[model samples]
Target: MSTPTDAAPAQPGVRKAGEDLLTVTDLHVYYGNIAAVKGVSLSVKQGEIVTLIGSNGAGKSTTLRTISGLLRPRTGTVVFDGKSLVGIPGHKVVGHGICQSPEGRRIFPKMTVEENLELGAFLRNDKAGIAADKERVLDLFPRLKERIAQKAGTMSGGEQQMLAVGRALMGSPKLLLLDEPSMGLAPVLVDLIFDTIRTIRDQGTTVLVVEQNALAALRIGDYAYVLESGHLKQEGVARELLKDDSIVKAYLGG
Candidate 1:
């Protein structure tokens, strides 16, 4: 299994530019004895928005966890850039430019908004760059600037979700993994969250998004995968999946 450490720089026409920023092949993960992800394979290309859509408990979060190094897969390969990510530590994964805005918006409740954002840059040494990224995140989500001094726990659900994304951006990741960014928000806030995702992609970061809002996710994504019981059920361009009758009826609420 080739790892990101062995990955070569983008070569001209070797395959194609911007293919597979992250690639997981035959990945299998377990929780103690229970296998949560089984032989799952997927890819996220550079600067593309790829969404993994499925019902709850369908191994969506587990897949992200494996990629982020939160859970080590029992078998399979995760290659980022060009090297394997299998044995990398979670924190080290961030340094390699993969950062995750986990599900449940797990912002530090005790910390002020700005403090939480600062922690996101703790591993980075470039003071000026950190300051600049902070400004950019604040600009992207003005509500965050307004609540900079407020405790993260005290903010509205939507605001906390925004802060989670901003904090991940603070790490200046090349690849961003988002888990259910639209969960538990009002319709308006959901729209805002999805819009922010689009803005993040436009800024040149590749994105692997896991979303329960299948309709919205498919609409925004460039490519998508459907998972069931930890296995790959389908894969296609997002538009193609959206138009699929079974997908439309089952997931899109059509």
Candidate 2:
């Protein structure tokens, strides 16, 4: 099981670049007695879109959940913006400027689109800012604006995915954690979703996404890490990895 520290040596210039906004050092997460993430380490620089790509049961979602405070790491640390996030409760994680659009598009089924978005800002009291953000989210997902009064469950999968991301943005996150944004979407919707991710990054929020769509994710990512069976197998510039024969063979279906 190679770790990021050792893996970096195999890929020169893969070390942390610029200013790191989020750093996970030797992270080890467990589900009951089984180790889900085994001594993984990675970093996301400010304003960059970093991705974690792997197959099923590779601990990709587990890493995001740990970073978002949904799961506790038995060892190692999660540092965001120079502050340690270890042991922080899940709900309070949002207040610290990290927000997650989880694996499944977990939008409020019974709530209208607008109401679901408002829930993202639950920790904030700045009414004006919240209102402004709502407009911004609507603008990002114009389809959402059209369905503002419609129930979230009634929307299509792509629309609900957009809503999930929009709701996370409404929280005004400094670092956005997106888990499997492209899962289960049609090819056209996948393109739209990945495009939207770039748009979000261009808008100035840093992103750390866990994705199963290796090709699409690597195409837009600044940097990427490969997780396999709870281990960090590779780490490098996304474009560089895209050209690697082994990576292409294993993850890109070449």
Best by TM-score: 2
C-alpha-based local distance difference test score of model 2:
0.91
| Candidate 1 off by > 4 Å | 1-17
lDDT of 2 by residue, 110-144 (tens): 99998999999989999999999998898888999
Q: Give one digit per residue, the lDDT tens place, for model 1 in 93-182.
A: 998998889999999999999999998898999999999999999999999999999999999999999999999999999999999999
TM value for model 2 = 0.94
Model 2 Cα shift for residue 140 (angstroms): 1.0
Off by over 4 Å in 2: 1-16
Q: What local lDDT does model 2 show for residue 54?
A: 95
Pairs in steric clash, model 2: none
